[model samples]
Target: MIAHVLDIFFPPLCELCREVLREGHSLCGDCAANLKRIESPFCQKCGEPFDGQIESHFSCPNCSTIELAFDFARSPLQAAGPARELIHALKYRSRFYLADEFAPFFMELLEQDERLSDLPQNTLVVPVPLHWWRQQIRQGNQANEIAKSFCQSSGLPFLPALQRIRRTETQTRLTRKQRLSNLHNAFRIREKMREKLTGATVILIDDVFTTGSTAHECARLLKKKASVERVIVLTLLRG
Candidate 1:
């Protein structure tokens, strides 16, 4: 076939370093190994990584005051190194294939975490939604792609239950308060999907976690409108 012929003439390169891959994949093992992973001694509520030896399950200074709406959130890697590169490639560069490479890190975290491993059987996986305009501009939603890939691998049900009702300014430079205000009432549960969320544990999915304002807004809407029992956020990177 033409595809096979192209492979023979120019074998697929690793997406990160452009090294010729023995097989086609987003990352070579070496680049994957170099990604900076988040370790323990993190806040029990927000999953913010901390330094030095500390007691486990304690709230970090920020979470102690801020009070996240979700029960907890976690990511396998920090938003740096190859992790950042992969996220940028997938989100901004239209490399849809990277979702396959990014999802296992989330699945592995779910498998390894004692709390996340024992979620209620009624847990629902929901991706952070993109506004219609943004989705049209981007040509696809990277978060949905990553969430669907994670759901497939983890045997969880994937739902496009949340919709962004308003377009908000980018949160990159926004203060925490500004980000919260910007996203207020921005997300709503789809009417048909509302009935399914009653008393269900919700696992909100996104590509990255920065101030967590977006996740918090989604969780608030889920709890207020759908009466979701619990909310746990899982993102590929903690920014």
Candidate 2:
């Protein structure tokens, strides 16, 4: 009853188009349709979508040449079009409400991945942490917000087990090597959560996977420092 009254006073508007919506959806039909999902022929290791035809699962050249800390990474959407806009809004524009909208997509990805669908009892969802300064400035961590919502819906345990001990420069224009260097020693396992990491499978949640430096660094820390059994990187998009 309260929700109905509130809706009458303030009709929900599509986050992208600003169109008044009759339902509780964050995006209108057209805008939602514009978001592109990552289909097959993608790199099995990094989830980078391939343009050509490939029947069997394969790793991209990038993954083959390098060692990654995580077991595998996957994303349901391509980081373009409406998907990019929504991510920017949540991370940059402080539109925290969009996190709930992203939860369903995470659930979809989990359901589709056979490995992730049947998670072990020791599995936990951990969001990639932002540096203290960035967290203070942003007033929230977008990854954390999304992870919380996903945990609520999926009945998974949420563990903020990592902390950004160093504040690194933005990796927007950096080379892959440079990005990795910048993130070196940037993360550490939280003292209180160290016990939880022993032989655990961590589902590292993040908003985007660009060059994968961030995810790799975090996974390395979890595996090396805390003896985490496995790390599966899950992001909203594969940038």
Best by TM-score: 1
lDDT of each: 0.88, 0.91
- Candidates in order, TM-scores: namely 0.96, 0.95
Cα lDDT tens digits, model 1, 1-239, are 99889988988888878998886376787887788888898878878898999964798777878867898999999998778988988998878889988777887798788998788889989999999999998889999999998988888999889999999988888899899999998988899999999999999999999888999999998998899999999999998
Per-residue alpha-carbon lDDT of candidate 2 for residues 89-190, written as tens digits (9 for 90 to 100): 999988888898888787888888787878999999999999989998998999999999989989989999999999889899999999999999999999
* Clash pairs detected, candidate 1: none
- Model 2 TM: 0.95
> Least lDDT summed over 10 consecutive residues: which range in candidate 1?
23-32
Instruction: For model 2, give the 10-residue run with minimal summed lDDT.
Output: 24-33
Which regions of candidate 2 deviate over 4 angstroms?
A: 1-3
After superposition of all CA atoms, the RMSD between model 1 and the true structure is 1.2
**Any runs in candidate 1 off by more than 4 Å, and if so which?**
none
